[model samples]
Target: MSFKSLCVAFGLTLSLAACAVGNTVDYRDVVPPLGVSGSKSVAVEAVDQRPYVLAGDNTPQWVGMVRGGFGNPFGVHTVSGAPLSSDLTQSIIDSLKQGGVKAVPATARMATDRTLLVTIKNWKSDSMVTTSIYIDAEAEVRDQAGTVLARNSVQERVVNEGEVAVLPPGKLERAKAVFRRLMDQLLNSSIRDALR
Candidate 1:
């Protein structure tokens, strides 16, 4: 092959290799093992996820190493995935239902005495040598009269190395695990307290 053709072929191979490096997994599969068991009906609104940031150019590159460190060696871009708000809301609703709560998706005309609202303040994963994930958010429970019954700020962390290896290997898997843990903490603490 000529010099120009060789250069183009090399570039194409690198591009393809990069594309194959990142894994895009679904958020729906990251279900936690614990949930509240109750007959109380609850409505969960689509969570507000405006503040959440997935992998980005500014995110440290070491995080990509946890997933085999190939496609995005620099970790300059995140593997594309689902919207956080939709996935998180659905996951919460599913978990509540599994726990025996009559959980339903919130709607404008729906009649429910209790409503749950969540706003994600931060969601991030990092690695110095090993991966760690952190989440911060606010949650509120209110009654039909719009009376706030309980409110709290929630934060959780999972370390992916040594004895604290709570997360899995892929970025999508790590995200799923983080979300599951975060929701578990939210339900067991703030939301449970509010319902009482």
Candidate 2:
């Protein structure tokens, strides 16, 4: 094959790889250990309201874009998979369990004393030479009667401009750290007070 032809083939291969992967981030991969336990019964739910990946409808890669994308010329945005709300919901569950909270999914049939509703106002990670993760969310503690007991908002913007975030899993690990901070911020602040 001609040298020019080889170059084209290589580019095609990289783009194809990007598409095949769909540039997604699984929230389950970012759950952190809370090291605290609670017997408090609560149901959790999350709804994503960002407009991005695939026109921001409902699908994976909602975590935001860390790097390359298939047909996306600007860049690729990471996804959560299928639907974002589900991913956030599960992530919250894992985080609560790590804290030893008797947490259950809002959609489940288990009995719960209170329900915590989380609206993902915005969650994204964009990186090229450097990576930055910005997460904004609102959490509400409600009684079994659906009365709001406490409301809290979490917004954090962290920029990892170090050489590490420019690497492979480095970017991913950076995002995980943000996820941990996000949960940590919530549980320690309003959530903790409400639970206590």
Which of the numbered candidates is closest to the native, going by highest lDDT?
2
- State the lDDT of candidate 2 residue by residue for 78-188, as single tens digits: 443346677667877877787778888888967787788888777777665566788888888887777888888888888877743244356666676777777677655
lDDT of each: 0.59, 0.66
- List TM-scores for all candidates, in order: 0.63, 0.71
lDDT of 2 at 116: 83
lDDT of 1 by residue, 103-130 (tens): 7778655777688887776655554335
- Give the clash count for each candidate: 0, 14
What TM-score number comes out for model 2? 0.71
